[model samples]
Target chain A: MEQSKKLSAGILRNDRLMADGRTIRYYDTSGQNRSAKDARPVEKQPAIGELRLDPLVNEWIAMASHRQGRIFLPPKELCPLCPTTGELLTEIPESDFEVVVFDNRSPSLRPPTGDWALPDQVGPDTDLGSAAGKCEVICFTAEHGNAFKDLTPARVRVLLEAWIDRTAELSQESFIEHIAPFENRGEEIGVTLTHPHGQIYAYSYIPPRVEKMLAAANKYKTSTGKVLFDEVVAREIRDEERIIARNDRWIAFVPYAARYPFEIHVAPLNPVADLTGLTDQDRDAFAPIALEVMKRLDGVFGIDMAYIAAWHQAPVRVGRDVLRLHWQITSVRRAPGKLKYLAGSESAMGAFIMDMRPEQSAAQLREVVL
Target chain B: MEQSKKLSAGILRNDRLMADGRTIRYYDTSGQNRSAKDARPVEKQPAIGELRLDPLVNEWIAMASHRQGRIFLPPKELCPLCPTTGELLTEIPESDFEVVVFDNRSPSLRPPTGDWALPDQVGPDTDLGSAAGKCEVICFTAEHGNAFKDLTPARVRVLLEAWIDRTAELSQESFIEHIAPFENRGEEIGVTLTHPHGQIYAYSYIPPRVEKMLAAANKYKTSTGKVLFDEVVAREIRDEERIIARNDRWIAFVPYAARYPFEIHVAPLNPVADLTGLTDQDRDAFAPIALEVMKRLDGVFGIDMAYIAAWHQAPVRVGRDVLRLHWQITSVRRAPGKLKYLAGSESAMGAFIMDMRPEQSAAQLREVVL
Candidate 1:
C-alpha cells in the first residue's frame, strides 16, 4: 500500500492506501508517529453503479443497488469506523487518530477509470452515464459516542482545515463539477452509523438545487450588478428578526422562506466561492459559530436535533463568481415524536408547505439558552 | 347554508355550505337522498398563510404556522372524514356517500378574496404574496377502516370522476395555475388521518417538479417533433421489463430512472393534458388499472405499502399540449421496518441515490402474487 505524509495549517496529514486499494487519510493537530498497515484480507468491492438521467426532470439518479447490503446501526464491538484492535480489524488501521477520511466502502460514485467518463449532457437516446465521481467519509473524531457539538473548537478547526484540503484536492479532478460536504446525523435521519462522521460527494454534474441557486444568482447578478449572496446576507442583517446567532466571520439565521420546520443558514460575512477560497483566519473563526448554532438547534425541543448539515459551495467548473459558500442545516423533526415527511406535495411536486413560520422558528431558536 | 343538487355521468352530486361557510360536495353512485347539513358549531377559521418566494431557488414556500395545532391521528370515534351520525357530526354531512370533497378546515392555500391575488411573477423586490388557491379533502369511502385498494372498481370510478369535476371547476378560477390531486396513504407517510382520503391542491403557480417536467417536454418536442409523454409510454412498452401492469387506456410502469426504491408511473395510452380531457370510456378503464397497480404495490412486501400517489395534471394556463396527465406513486419504504430517508445528497442537493434498480423493482412488483 502506498503511503505519504505532509503538514499543512498546523495539521499533520498521513495518506495511505487500504488493502482493498481504497485511499485513507488521517489528520492530527499534534504530530504523532503514524505508521499503520491494513493487514486484513482484501475484500471484494461492490460493483460501481451507473447514473441514469431522467429526461422528464433533467436530473441524474445514481442506481447503487449494491448499497442495500451496507452496514446498518451495527453494535459498537463490530463498528467498522472504530480504530482497529489486535483481534478486531476495522476500516481504520491506526490505533488512534484525531480525524480521518477514507473512500466509502459502498459508494454511490467512484472515480472514473478506463474509458468511464461522465457525459456532459444526456438526451432521450443518451440517458445513462458512469456514476464517476468520488465519495469519502470524514470521521470527526475516533470517539464513538461523542457528537459534533461535544467537540472542542480546536478540533473543529482541524476538521474544517481537513475539509479545505480535501476540497482543494478533489477539485483537481476534471470530471468532478461540484463538491458537497455534508453530515446526516442521528438515527432519525437514517444514519446507518452511530459514529461521528460526515460525507463529501464529488458530483460529475451540478446538482439540481445548486443549479437552481446558480441560475438565480446569475439572474440577480445580471439584473442588479450585485452578488446574490451578499444581498441575501445584507437583507438578513437588516431584518434582524430571523438572525439567531452571528460572529465576526459568520452569521446564522433562519431563512426568510424556510422549507423545513427547523432550518438555519450559516453564511460567511466575507464572500468565498468555495471552501478552498477560505482564509486560515476564516476557517478558524467558523468553528465556534458552527458549534454555537448546533448547540442552539439541539437546545430547541430539548432533544439531540437530527439534522442534515450541508455545505453549499460553488461548482468547480462554473458559477464560481455568482454562487457563494454557505452551510444549510435542516431538521425533519417538527415536534417531539413527530416528523415532517415529504408527502404527496413535497415528494411528487417539489412544493413545500412549511408548518412553522420563519420568524417564530427564529425566535424559538434564539430563546434557547446556550 | 346554500344547497344545490345535480347529476353528472350517472352519478348524483350535491353541494352544500358548512356552518363555517366552506363548500362540501358529495358524489353518490346509488341514488340516495343526500340532504344532511353540517350543523356543528361554526369554528373560527385559521389565519391564511402567505406564500414567500425563495429567490435562491426560484420557488414559493407556504408558511402555515397555524397548522401546528391541526389534528394528528385522532381516534376512530373522532375520525373527521367519516359520515356524520345523528350524535356526532364530522366533515361529511351525509350518512353515506361514495365520494365526498370538502374545503380543508386548515388550508395551506385559500381562494383569493377582494384585493388579494397571486402575482404573475415574483422578484427580489416582491417576494411575498397571498397563498391564494383552493385546498380540498376527498374522502374515498364512508367506511373508516377501508383503504383505497379495498374500494370497489365502481367506487374508484366515481372518485376519478369527482377529481375530473373538481379539476374543471378549479380551472375556472383565474388565480389557480395548476391543480393536483394526490393521496398520501399510510401512517408512515405522515398521514394525520387514518380515514381513506386524498387531497386536491389548486396552486397559484406551477409546482417545481411539474415545471421541470414541462420544460423537458417542451425541449423534447422542439428537438424530436413528437410528444415526450407519448415517447416515454412507447419506450416503456418497447422495454417490457419495467412494465408491471397495463390496460388498453393506461400503462403502469416503473420509470427508466426511478428515484425511489418502489415507484410506478401510470400514464394514459392517449395524450390527455388534464383529468377533464379523459373520455367516459377512459375514466371507466382507469379504475381497474389503478386498482391493479395499487394492489401489486401492496403485494410487494405483503404489507400495506405506504405511498404518495400524485396525479400530475397540466397547468391551467399553460403546457396544455406538451404536458400529459400521469400518476406518479412513490413509496419511501425500502423494506419491511426500514425506510429510505432523503439524506444529505437528496434533501440538500436534490441528487437522488437509489438503493434499488428500477428494472429490478419492477420485476419484484411483477412477481408479487395478487
Candidate 2:
C-alpha cells in the first residue's frame, strides 16, 4: 500500500491494503507506530455495480444487488467496525486506533473500469454504465458507544481535518464529480452499524440535489450580482429569529423553508468553495459549534435523535465560484414517539409538507442547554 | 355546498357541507339517498398554511404546522373513515356508502386567500404565499379493515371513475395546477388510518418531480422527434423481462431504473395524458391489473408491504400533451423485517442506491400467484 505524507494537524496517516485489495488508512493523533497487515484471509472482491439512468427524473440509480446481504445490526462482539482484539477480528487490523477509514466492503460505486458509456435510450435495454467511484467509511473512535457530539474538541478537530484531507484527495480523481461526507446516526435512520462512523461517497456525476443548488446559485448571482451564500448569511443575521447560534467565524440557523421537523444549516462566515479551501483557523472554530448543534439536537427529543448531517460543498470541477460549502443537519423525529416518514407527497411528488414551523423549531432548539 | 351535475356513470354525487364549512361528497353505486346533514357541532376551521419557496431547490414547501396534532394510529372503534354507527359518529355521516370524497379536516393545502406573492429575495424573510389548493380524501370502501387489493373489480372501477371526475373537476380551478391521487398504505409507511382510502392533492403549482419529468419529456421529444411516452411503452413491450402484466389498455412493468426495493410502473398503453383523458374502456380495463399488482406486492413478503401508490399525471394548464399518465407503486420493504429508509445518500443528495435490481424485482413479482 502507498502511504501519503503526514498532514500538518499532528495526525499521522498510515495506509494499508486490506485482504480484498481495498485501501485502508489510520489517523493516529499520538503519532504511534501502526501495523499494516491484515490477519484475515484474503477474499475475492465483490463485482462493481452498474448505474442506470432514470429518464423521467434525469437522475442515475446505482444498482448494487450485492449490498442486500451486507452486515446488519450485529452484536458488539461481532461488530465489524471495531478494532481487532484478541478474540474478535474486525475491519481494522490494529488492536486499537484513534481513527480509521477504509473502502466499503459492499460499495455502491467502485473504481472506474475505463468504459464510461451513457445510456442512449429512454427505456430498459441494458443501457448502463459502470458504477465507478468510491465509497469509504470513516470511524470517529475505537470505543463504540459514543457519538461525534460526545467527542472532545481536539478529537472533533482531528475528524474535521481528516474530512478536509479526504475531500481534497477524492476531488483529484478524474472520474469523481462530487464528494459527500455525511453521517447517518441512530437505528431509527436505518443505520446498519451502531458504531460512531461517517461515510464519504465520491460520485461519478454531480448529485441531483447539488446540481439543483448550483443552478439556483448561478441564477441568484446573475440576478443580484451578489453571492447567494453571502445573501443567505446576511438575511439570517438580520432576521435573528431563525438563527440558532453564531460567532465571529460561523453561523448556524434553521433555514426559512426547512423540510424536516428539525433542520439546521451551519455556514462559515468566510466564503469557501469546499472543505479544502477552509483555513486552519476556520477548521478550529467549527468544532465547538458542530458539537453544540448535535448536542442540542439530542436534547430536543431527550434522546439521541436519528439525523443525517451532510456537508454540501461545491462540485469538484464546476460551480466552484458560485456554490459555497455548508453543513445541513436534518432530523425526521417529529415528536418523542413519532417520526416523519417520507410517504405519498414527499416520496413521490418531491413536495414537502413540514409539520413544524422553522421559527418554532429554532426557538425550541435555542432553549436547549448544552 | 353546490352539487355538480351527474356524469354518464350512474354514481350519484351528493355534495354536503361539513361542520367547519368544508365540502364533502358521496358517490353511491346504488343511488342510495344520503342524510346530507351533519350531526356534529360546528367548529373553527384550521387556518390555511403558507407555501414557502425553497430557493435552493426551486421548489415550494407547504408549511402546515397544525397538522402535527392530526390523528395518528387510532383504534378500530375510532377509525375516522368508517361509516357512522350507533355511538360512533365518524367523519363519514351516513351508515353505508360505496365511496366517499371529503375535504380533509387538517389539510396541507386549502382555498387561496387571494394574497399570492412570489418571494422577491432568496433568503429567510417569510417570503411566502397562501397554500392555495384543495386536499381531499377518497375512501375506497366503508369497510373498517380491508386493503385496496381486496376490493372487488366493480369497486375499483368506481374508484377510478371517482378519480377521473375529481381530476377533471379540479383541473378547471385556476389555482390548482396539478392533481395527484395517491395512497400511502401499511403502518410502516406512516399510514394513520387502516381503512381503504387514498388522497387527492390539488397542488397550486406543478410538483417538483412532475416538473422535472415534464422537462425531460420535452427534451426527449425535441431530440428524437418522437413522443417519449410512446417510445417508453414500445420499448417495454419489446423487452419482456421487466414486464409484470399487460392488457390492451394498460401495461405494467418495473422501470429500467427503480429507486425503491420493489417498484412497478403502470402506464396506459394508449398514451393518455391524464386520468381525465381515459375512455370508459380504459377505465374498466385498469381494475384487474391494479388489483393484481397490489396483490403481488403483498405476496412478495407474505405481508402487507408498506408502499406508496402514486398517480403521475400531466399538469392541468401545461405539459398536458407531453407528460403521460402513469401509476408508480413503490414499496419500502427490502426484506420481511427490514425497510429501505432514505437516509444520507437518498435523502440528502437525492442520489438513490438501489438494493435490488429491477429485473429481479419484476421476476419475483411475476412468480407470485395472484
Candidate 3:
C-alpha cells in the first residue's frame, strides 16, 4: 500500500539569496498529514537534494545527501504514480479516459475530500527537477496481467496508434525535446503496479547516452559511408545467426555487444527518427509482430516473460533523418528463477558477457509457432 | 514444470575448420541432467544447436535451428544447471575434478553442455578447439530460496573472497584477457535460476562497453587533470547530496547519470584496480558496509529487495591502472509497489530519467536511522 497519509505538502521557502558560501539549500519539513483524499491541488514537497543543472548534458540529476540510501528495492504490485487513495485507488486522466491520464487525480484514484495538506517548505526542485520536461503515465490496459503480448493483433495495432498519438501530442509541448516511451514487465524487473501501463518522459534536453550513440552513428557514417546499425544488421542477416524474429518492417536480433544476457533489438527496415514517421500500416503491422514477439518470448520459456522494450527514436524537432529507429528489448529471464545479478562487471564497468549464444536464443524463438 | 521432453543438448565443432564455413554447429537433443549437489561422470547426448565459432569475437555461439519455437522461459524451480536425471550432455569442459565446469544444456551458455541421457558424438574441433575462457558456477548456498542477498554478510564476504581468489587465479591463464563476474537476481531481469549463486566468466577480450567507459574516463582525465569518478565523488560530498554512507576508507554516492532509479555506487577513497589491491582489513570493512547498505535498503522498502551490487574493477592484466575500482548497487524499486522500468530511454538509447529527487530520497532514508 502506498502512503495514503498526505501531509500538508507545500514549499514555504523561496529565499534564493546566498545563505552559505556553498550552494546549500534549506527547507522546512513541517506539514499536516491528512488521510482524506481531495480534489484540491496537492502542494509539492520541499526539495531535499540539489538538482545540479548539467549544461553539457543538459539534464537535471537528483543529487541529494541521503539519496543513495533511499534507492530502495521495489515491491511487487503498487504504482508510485498513483494518487493517495484508500485501498481502492483512483485512476488517471480525469477525462473518461480509455486509459487514465490526468492532471488532476482520476476519480477512482483520488482520496475522498480531505483538509488542505499544506507543508511548511519544499525542495529547490521536485520531480527529478529537469527545470523542463513532462513525466506522465500511459495506461496500457485496464486489466491486470494484461500485456502487449495478450492483445489481439488488431488490438495491439490500437496500442500502437495510442503510442503514435501520444508521441505527436506530447511532442507538441514547447518545453519538451525528447519523448521516451517504454514499458517494464515482471516482478524481477521490480514493477510496482501490476496494471498494464507504461510511461512517457519528455525531456528538455538531449541525454548524454543518446548523444554518445548519435555521435557514434554520425562518426560511423563519416568514416564508413554507411550507417553502422545498417551495416551491422546487414551482416547479421547475412550470417543468419542472431535473428530472433522478423517482418518486412523490422528484424529482431541479439546485439553483438549485448549488455544483458538476453538482449533483443528490433530494427526497422526503413530508418525513421521517432514515431512521427511511423505510418498507420507500419504500426498496424507492428501489432502481430509485437504480440508474436511477446508470445514467442513466452513460448521460448513456457512461462510469462519479463522485458523492457524501449522505443529508441530521434530527439524531437531535431533532423535525425539519418538515424535509424529501433526497439531494444532486454529480458531478465535468460535463466529461469535465478536472475543475472550483475555482480562485479556488467553493473560497474559496463562490461557484458552473454552466457547463451544469440543463435541459440533465436532458434529457440523460431521453434515457437506463434 | 521444465520441458521434460528434452531437446538435443549442444555439440561443439571447435576447430580452425569451424571458421571455414559461414556458420557451423553441433547439437545434443538428449542429455542427462546433473545435480550440482552430486557429481557424476556420464556420457552425454548431442544437441540440436551446434556450437558455432565467432572468429572476430573469438567466442563460440550456438546454432540451434530446432530451438526456433522452443520456450525461452526458464522452468519453475528446475534449474538447467542442475538436472536430476537424463541423457548425458555434451560440450562440457574436459577437466575431471572435485567440480567440473560444463556448458549449459540449453545450447548457448558458454561452450554448450551435452547430456549422458542421449547418445553423444564428438565434433570436428573438439580436439583442436581453443576456448576463450572458463564459465563456472559457484553454488553459494544449498537452499533454493536463499540468494546472495539472503546470505549473511559473513557469507557475502566469503563470496567476495571467492571472487578475488578466482579472479586472481583465472588472470593467470595465458589465454584469458578479462575476468567478468556477475549475478543476476529475479526472473524479471531474465534470471532463470532459483538458487543463490553467481558466475565468473573469463573472457579473451575487453568488451566494447568497458572500452567505451575507459575511453570516456581517459578523455575526462585528459581534460580535467583528475579522475572522473573522484571528481564526481568530491562534487557529491561538497553538494551533500546523493551520498548514502561514508567511512574513513569508503564512500557511497548515487551518480547523477543514474540508469536505474535507486542506483548507488560504493567506492574506496584510494585509487586501485580490481579487488586485488584491497587490503584484508578493507575486505573485512566491506562486510559491514554490504550489510548496512542492504540493511538500509531493506529498511526503506521493508521487503526482499532486488538489487545488483556489481564490482567494477580494472581489467585483469591491462597494462594501465586507468579506472578506479567501484561497486554499483542498483535497485529498480521506485515507490513501494511500483518499479522503475528500463523502458524507452534507458534500455534503448541509454538515457535515464529518475522520478524522485535524490535529496528528498536521502533525507527520507537518512531519517530512517538505518
Q: For residues A247-334, what per-residue lDDT tens digits would candidate 3 score against the true structure?
A: 8887887765454556777877776677768765566567756776788888877887777887777777663754667777788676
Residues B1-370, candidate 2, lDDT per residue (tens digit)? 6565575467678787776677778877777777746688887788779898777777899999989998898999899899888888888888888888999999999977665434556543446787888899999998878999999998898898889889999998878889999999988888998899999999988898888888888887788776776777777778789999988888999988889999999988888889988988898899989999999999987898989999999999888778899999999999998999898999999999999999999999999987
Full candidate order by DockQ, most accurate first = 1, 2, 3
Per-residue accuracy of model 1 over A182-275 as CA lDDT, tens digit each: 9999888899999899999999888999998998899888888888888888888998999999988889999998999999999889989998
Stretches > 4 Å off in candidate 2: A115-126, B2-4, B115-126
Which stretch of 10 consecutive residues in model 2 chain A shows the poorest summed lDDT? Answer: A117-126
Question: If the candidates were sorted by their lDDT against the true structure, best first, what order would they fall in?
Answer: 1, 2, 3
Candidate 2, residue A269: the lDDT equals 92
Error of 2 at B240 (Å): 0.8
TM-score: model 1 vs. ground truth: 0.98
Q: Give all TM-scores, in the order shown.
A: 0.98, 0.98, 0.61
Question: How does residue B216 of candidate 2 score in lDDT?
Answer: 82
Error of 2 at A138 (Å): 0.3
Error of model 3, residue A186, in angstroms: 5.1
Q: Write one digit per residue (lDDT tens) for candidate 3, span B139-255.
A: 454444665546666555555666665677677866566666666565545454555656666655564455555665676656666665566666677777778887777777766
With a 3 Å backbone cut-off (N, CA, C), the pairs that clash in candidate 2 are: none
